[model samples]
Target: MEKIEKFEIYQRRFLGNKLKVMPLIEKIIESEIKNFNSFCDIFAGTGTVGWYFNKENLQIITNDLLYSNYIPLRAFLSDEEFDEKKIEELLKEFNSIKDCEDNYVSINFGNKYFCNNNARIIGEVRERIHKYFLNDIINPKEKAILLTSLLYAMDKIANTVGHYDAYRNIKDIPYKPLKFLMPDIDKRKNQNNLIFNMDANILIREIECDVLYIDPPYNSRQYSDTYHLPENIIRWEKPELHGKAMKFDRSTLKSKYSSKEAAKAFADLIENAKCKYILFSYNNMANKGHSRSNARISDEEIMEILSKKGRVKIYEKEHKEFTTGKSKRGDNKERIFFVKVKK
Candidate 1:
């Protein structure tokens, strides 16, 4: 089989609002009367938007609660140049590891999310990557790149649609062999590039940038719950899981964005953001009759919070939401709030 050249193949598989609003964001950036040197993605899900800005010579700072997301951010946003030969050699070594029996993912998730064979392979590969890190064989950036490769590879062959909530009920699951690929490293280096794996609320207080882009969860769905399997693979701590979804204890990873406190959290973020301009991407999915109709904050609430901080302008574009179950497709619109902070 021929190799795919698309840089966003893995990112396209991510389960969230990403990449779709880039053109609109770019337009906003151009028109918003900005002179920005540093860009911050406070809720960098897959680092897609931040990476987009990084290419435009902005010093990028990306933060996410999920450990899985941090891996890719570290790999893509690093200032250091990576040798293609070294990356290829690392991939070769990772692929060469034989699938072992009863590894963490295999023992817990075998015959559940992935088939036993694939699960075993995931476990073995994870172990090898962990071992490489422990033995100091690979540097921190190299470890991130290799782990990100494995994460993307596993995502490709996952039996679910995009998330790890449930696996498809199939008698004979498709056995696609896992293959690691080199991530498209951003060579246009910015010395101040930073990545963080912390709660957005806490992180916002410490970082100050010229442009702050906020893309928090719109509904009551916690990302840690949705992407638990990937998080597990990233942390590699062999956590104690529970319930039908086989989720680990994510008590520490829960976001206020998914709770009744969401409005307050949004307000706090806006207050704490040290930026000239703030852009927020949110969807009008609250009134849409769906399982996730329980939106954390209303549009009016969001507008009210943001208005207190600055002069705000709203942009709207129709978007097709990817949903499952008995959710009917309807008119979906993504709203971007461009705010000029009050000096």
Candidate 2:
């Protein structure tokens, strides 16, 4: 039985905005919190923070723009318990699926993201999973678990540094067999949890919880651009692709936090947050040199927006920023702003 943290291992390698300060968050919640029964993770990237609260007996409502991320959130946050034997049998059935020629990934991604044979195998596995889903061989949750497992497996063997931006040259590509692992989902009974695949700004309006956690994109790097391959896999949408990256049309998934409107967007989120306490996780990359200038929102803007909504207390911790082996480390610090909303 692998640990639940293994699910986040691959993501931590690339994704920058992970909740590494969860212990600090818990400490704050214990010290200043009056009453907290539910939590809403508006920018639930990998559902790490949501899972943390869920374990502490709080009902979790999590949302993310990426379907790839939503899959794991659905699997982990749901109260339904799955049979280990059933899941194991299903994995065996999926792994037994023979590689077929000329499928979606093989035809499109062959010799690009993976070797031709591996791509064909990936296509074969994905097609089989969908077939099981359509034929009612598996329930919706079961399907999500399987698909997420496959996505994680594919990510391990992908021929890239971490993201799907570019693949390694043919000669450098690793030749390893694809494998899947059942996600370390919590089996304990929980209160009904909700999961959504929508923009954070849009989702904040419809739900009210005791705590709202926001960890939006910190820079111009659109997550859809970085993890497009996994998105394509989970969506199974074989849309027209462009450039050397083979990326699909992601016009609708762009975040305001990654553009010139970031400050306004942050302000809007704080103003509209229908929660008692809003805990925001952002970094201090804007203070660094221009070469390491990835942050779209400045420190002053964050304080200005958060202070207007409630009594804001800021916490900071030193952390390393993720880079592509190009930029120098500029004083990186992850900050958390706890806003106690005015009644």
Candidate 3:
């Protein structure tokens, strides 16, 4: 059979929101789908893996700790109807709101981040989005689309640098937001599904499924930093910002998920998760701790723990893009490690 791409994740989110190589994952689970009627994704990031695997009429469980992450996933995967006309109407009302300044847009706390025009547009749209949620006129899919559209708009108009590091370079206005930024999304046929707002480690113990898919943060690149602005916009709550006009807590904080405890923590999560099979998606990087830090979990470290679980099967593929100039990209191999627990 030929390899086919299920979702266009990379094309849609190239500069930010990088994803792990997924074909190996598709192949690993291709044979096992029949045995399991329910699926659970602990780190359901953008729902790329869960949404793609949502064939066979099986229920999919998706989770993420951040409110921003949870909102988008919930919007995408939940059982909700999407009403286009109503959303359009809401947008009309939102864009009518007055700008605080000619170029000023209202962010959290009425503090301005972008140029007045960008902020004004974002502020107006955000107001209407909040109204939509309050009126409760539509379902979860609609909500997700609303959230997604806003994020996409934010990405284009945001003054910050790519990958959401800071706004130091974005010293001016941005391109205008198109009306159909989010368009419409197909509602996931999520039968018997679950969504969670907890840590990956904590949830592993309680959830049980035939297959568990783990694509954790490869290095210490905290996810919060990469997409922090969109998260803030969706949260619709102004947070204290440290520098470059982003949420202080998110930008300045450390994630236990940030390889601060990745090795022991992930091993524990995998060990305790009451699942028959486990597949981990990570690359073999010499620099593991973080961009400017040391290694926390090495290639040997992970293989050791997963080895104890079952007879491990490994497949590696090239990372299509990376900052490094290497042919294989950041790591020589984007490793897929599969372990099966006896039923």
Model 3, 1-343: lDDT tens digits are 2221122222244331325556667777786444677777787776677777675468777787666667766656666656766666555544444554431135442223355555666766766567766887655566666676666555555554455665544434444543334343455465556777678888887788877887776666677776666766777676666665545577433456566687888778867988878877776665532353333577787889887787788877875434533233334566778888765
Q: State the lDDT at 108 in candidate 1.
A: 90
Candidate 1 lDDT over residue span 1-343, tens digit each? 2342324423547766577878889889998855689999999988888888785467899989889888888988877555567667768766666657787888898887888888998888888778877997777888887888888888888888888877777777878777788788756664679889998989988999988999998888788888999999889999898987789999998899988899999999898888888899888888776646556789889889999879789998887776775677578888898898998
Off by over 4 Å in 1: 1-12, 80-83
User: What is residue 193's positional error in candidate 1, in angstroms?
Assistant: 0.6
Best model number under TM-score: 1
- TM-score for each model: 0.94, 0.92, 0.81
Q: Which ten residues in a row have the lowest lDDT in candidate 1?
A: 1-10
In the predicted model 1, the residue pairs found to clash are: none
Writing each residue's lDDT as its tens digit, candidate 2 over 78-128 gives 766566666677777666656577888988888888877788988887887
Which candidate do you rate higher for lDDT, 1 or 2? 1
What do the candidate models score in CA lDDT, each in turn?
Answer: 0.82, 0.79, 0.63
Stronger candidate by lDDT (1 vs 3): 1
Please report the TM-score between candidate 3 and the true structure. 0.81
